[model samples]
Target: MLSDLVDLVLPATCALCHRPGGALCAGCRADVTACLHPSPRPAVPSPPPPGMPSCWVTGEASGALRAVVTAYKDEDRRDLAPQLGRWLAPALRAAVGQDGSARRALHGRGLLVVPVPGSPRARRRRGDVPLLAVVSEAAGGLGGRAVVATVLASTRVTRDQSGLDARARAANLHGAMTVRERQERAVSGAVCVVVDDLVTTGATLAEAARALHAAGAAQVLGAAIGATRRRVLVPANSPGPAG
Candidate 1:
């Protein structure tokens, strides 16, 4: 078949390292998993504006994690979604306490994984939303029991969040997203996990959460492929980088 011929010729090179057999080579896959693992201090949720929901950061946002997330998100390298989702799965599993006996204790709880819908502009540029791909792959890895929902939509087009501080970002997205009337039933009574490709100022995720909550989602928790950590920059003449 033509598909088989293409596979034979290209051999599916790894997205991270270009290894000619797997989606991600073993070394790069290990690095991705290590970068996304839960940190000692779980990110706390920031209070968002009305109609917006709160979001928590699970892992520290260092240069390494940010680089991987940015590469996939901004550069349109969607082939990395599966590998990124694989890295994200373990931390998400841990956040919900899926190891050992806890897994059964949480079974059938009806957790819905809803990706934060991207703008039409972004989709047009990228050809697809990265979070959807990540969430879909993650759902498959989770064995298909948990529901992966895309019940929210962007009702208004908004400016890109790049170059905006937290406050500006929040303002830009205010009143920009909404849950469609038909999809309300899907979110109601479900513990919604809002997934995104990255969280910089947390504005987008917060808005997405708010939309879901307004639609009657029981509880909304935030998850992402990565987040931005506060970095202390050392000036050239600064003493010991300031305590």
Candidate 2:
């Protein structure tokens, strides 16, 4: 497989299980795959983070998934971008709602994928928004109708979110982002899908939605690689169908 070849050349090792082969070996990928569902599911943060937008996730953020996400976000695994980006594709497709009719509509209307902004501090530390590459890759697979746009920017400095509970997370991110004035014209009337690497309290996605809506976006949906299952509330114990 192509991934296996890349693994060999890069001397890859599994970020989760540490198996020597790929950043995520086939076994760990299967673990993530088992939880992936094509349909968009609601990710309501417990206590419900205010301003949180509706979101679809590929898997619960735990075990191998969580470890891999951490490695990508903090451990300088930029090479893992393609692999993680592929993992994020289903959720992006789910957010786009690819039923026959919806697919045709999307092909005509075009899709704009926007990554939720990371703090400048984190951006400097990590070199970029880790989810941007993933979103770009996912957008590439959407034919010629979709494009990745980095339009949101943090409006102020926010503290590290690691120790925060749901409430604190909400407080930390509320009104912390904005759509650039230059991008507002482009955002207007666009079907924007907010992309993120992980969703814990849903604060970040919520904030992204708020910024997009404020800029005149026609509609917004969220896509993520994983979300905290314990924190999110999905309907009917099943992934919700369509966006």
Candidate 3:
């Protein structure tokens, strides 16, 4: 639909291999799949920032997966949204399913899948919040009452996180996010899964969790499509990097 229209305007090229055809060629898609964990697994950052929620990841954020994420967010590759959503679905399911409290909450209060808010500056530059569409798509595939909520808001501007170490990243994001006042009632006593595109230092997710907890959410779990390999322990059965 929209991807086809966009492709017609600006010929599709694989984000990783630069092959002309689609946002990602079949070969590159296979390589990206190889990066995925055999199953979703815990992704705890070393020296995890305070307020960090229990988190899970679908794949290691390196090579093909990382390139795809960068292109989707910064390089104007909106066509990759469906692929990103599919990749994130497993982690989202695992985050909610493995938590006893989350599973129980599903029957009564329902589930909230909240994407970490994008910066106003970034949104202006990109013309959209790419994570929102992907999060909605993933949550929709959960087959039950998973609701995508844009409840969190960026409270202040922060410096770029690229060069920052764990501590600096935590400091930069501390007090940077808050739940919207109008949405506080919905968040009260809700079980929320705060999701992100990637987990490096985990500062962003921690901040989002903190804000949700402050607003009275009963539980706040975390999920992401990928995580930096150094901070997360990959499973032994996972396949080696793709050729």
Candidate 4:
């Protein structure tokens, strides 16, 4: 709603189609929605890196969906965060429902939604990590079943992942993230859903899970708004209801 008001006062073009309108025009909005899978499904990278938690995604990161994510993250089209979060919510809910720790958290402790940490260099360039707010927005829709936490932090600078292959990406991120000492208690015994705006090689999410598990997280799962079309589907064996 605020984004609409902002757009009204300051005209903006659709991130995907460049049509003059709100952050995304109605037609393009439909196109993005069409990108979403009818149900969230497992999306693992081929040769998934070690510690890659079971993962799910709402859509393929291509065309309108990919364009919107790029605009929101790199082009300063922050207004699109709300829409991205809306797209991400169902995938998150599905991950929570399927993970034993997260399912139990629904009635016992509580689910923790942690955004994968971006590189420090990227933070310096962007001024802030946009995924934090995006994750907060998405987790809010979980009906009090989840709490957003920033437990993971990058331990060293890493190169941009844009041009990296799966192995290179895994090596770049390995040993890059850790749970901040002060926040370790928040992760211990928690059921965490590591949220990322997009998943390309699955290396980033895998690295994030490693840190959380090292911090004593009871279980870790991954959720993303979209994933690269290049993925290996994990067999459907979880008992949780499909999204």
* lDDT score for candidate 1 against the true structure: 0.65
Best by TM-score: 3
Clashing residue pairs in candidate 2 are: none
| Model 2 error, position 47 (Å) | 3.3
Better of 2 and 4 by TM-score: 4
Task: Mark the regions of model 3 whose C-alpha exceeds 4 Å error after superposition.
Answer: 1-6, 9-11, 231-243
The order of the candidates by TM-score, greatest first, is 3, 4, 2, 1
Write model 2 residue lDDT over 142-200, tens digit each, in one string: 77478688989899989898899878888888889999889988888887889888888
Give RMSD (Å) of candidate 4 vs. truth: 6.5
Candidate 2 segments whose C-alpha is farther than 4 A from its true place: 1-10, 17-19, 34-40, 98-105, 231-243
Candidate 3 lDDT tens digits, 1-243: 776676678878898789797879999999899899999988888878888999999999998899999988887677798989999999998998899888876656688889998767667756435599889888887766788989998888899899999999999999999999999999999999999999998899999999999999989999999998765567778999992
lDDT of 1 by residue, 1-243 (tens): 575687667766765566775656677666665665445233443433343333434455665566667667776656677777765665455444523322432366666778887777767766535478878777565553567777877887888778877788888987778887888887777777777766666788778877887788777766665666644455667677364
Span of 10 residues, lowest total lDDT, candidate 3 = 121-130
Residue 79 displacement (Å), model 4? 0.5
- lDDT, residue 228, model 4: 81
Highest lDDT: which candidate? Answer: 3
Candidate 4 local lDDT, 22-120, one digit each (tens)? 789999999888889999877777777888888889998888898888888777787788888999988998898787768788667788889987667
